[model samples]
Target: MRNFLVSSLILGSSLVALNTNAAGTDSTTFQVKITVNESCKFTNAQDVNFDAIDRSTGKQNTATGQLDITCTLGTPYKIALNGNGKMSNASNSGSTIAYNLFQDAQYSQAWDKSNTLANTGSGNSQALTVYAKLTGENNVEAGNYLDTVTATVTY
Candidate 1:
C-alpha cells in the first residue's frame, strides 16, 4: 500500500510540471502585423483681415482713401465712405473682403461707384466707395458726425 501511494504521488507531480497551458501562451511564432490609414488634406480657403490706418476712427482708412462728409442747413448732408483693399496673395494671400456704407439715411443723400469687392490675383488693389446724404432744416444740428465700420473675416 505504501509503494502504491508513493507511485501515485510521483505521477501527480510529473503532470503539474508539464504544464501545457503555460506553453500554449508562449510567443514563439511571433506573427507581427501592422495596419495604417492616411487621409487627404486641403488648403483652408479663409478670408483675410481688413483694417484702416488713419486719424478719423471709431477709434480709423484706405489706399489712403477718405470718408469725406459735407452737411448744410435746409440741404441734405452728402457724405461718402471710401477705401481700397490692396492685399497681395503672397504678403496676405488667398483672402477676400468687401465694403459697405451708410449712404442714404434720414436727412441724407448717398453714392457708391465701386460696390462689390472682387478677388484678384493680378497683384492689383481693389477699391471700394459708398455715398450718403442727409437732409437738414434751417436749424440743422452739427457736431462730429461719426459711424461704426465693421470688417468680418472667416476661415
Candidate 2:
C-alpha cells in the first residue's frame, strides 16, 4: 500500500506538471497595411454631332454634349480638345465645315490645345458640358459632314 501511494503521488505530480506546461502562454504579432494609388478614368463621353447643319444660314449653329470623368480625390486636371476646325464629309471629299468648342455657355472659353480647361476631382463622377458652335461662313458643298475631336485630360 505504501509503494502504491508513492507511485500514485508521483503520477499525480507528473500530470500536474503536464497541465502546467499545457497552460503555458505563447505570443505573436499581427500586422496590417494599406495603400492607395492615384488613378483616373473617363466614364462616358458622347460625340458632339450637329445633324443636318445649314450651310447658308449665316448664323452660328450651336450644340452641346457632355463628358463624364472620375478620378481620385483632390486631383487637379486640365481638359483640352484637339482637332482641326474643318469637318470633312465622308462621301464628298470636297465638302467641309468649320466649328469650334467652348467650355462656357457664353461661348468665350474655347476648349483647345492652346488653352486648357482646368477642374478639380471630387473622387466621384463629374459631368462636363461642352459647348460647340459651328461657323456659318462656310460655303462648301452640301453633304454629310463629320469630325472627331479628342478630349484629352492632363494631370
Q: Which candidate number has the best lDDT?
A: 2
Q: How many clashes show up per model?
A: 17, 0
lDDT of candidate 1 over 1-155, digit per residue (tens): 99999999999888887775456653455577985332212112222233432322332121112221222222222222233422222333333222333333331323333332222222222232333222222121222223343332111
The lDDT of each candidate is 0.31, 0.84
**Worst-scoring 10-residue span by lDDT in model 1:** 133-142
Best by TM-score: 2
Q: Cα miss at 132, model 1 (Å)?
A: 2.5
| lDDT of residue 102 for candidate 1 | 33
Off by over 4 Å in 2: 1-18
Query: Candidate 2, after superposition: displacement of residue 74 in Å?
Result: 1.6
lDDT of 1: 0.31
Q: After superposition, how far is residue 80 of candidate 2 from its true place, in Å?
A: 1.8
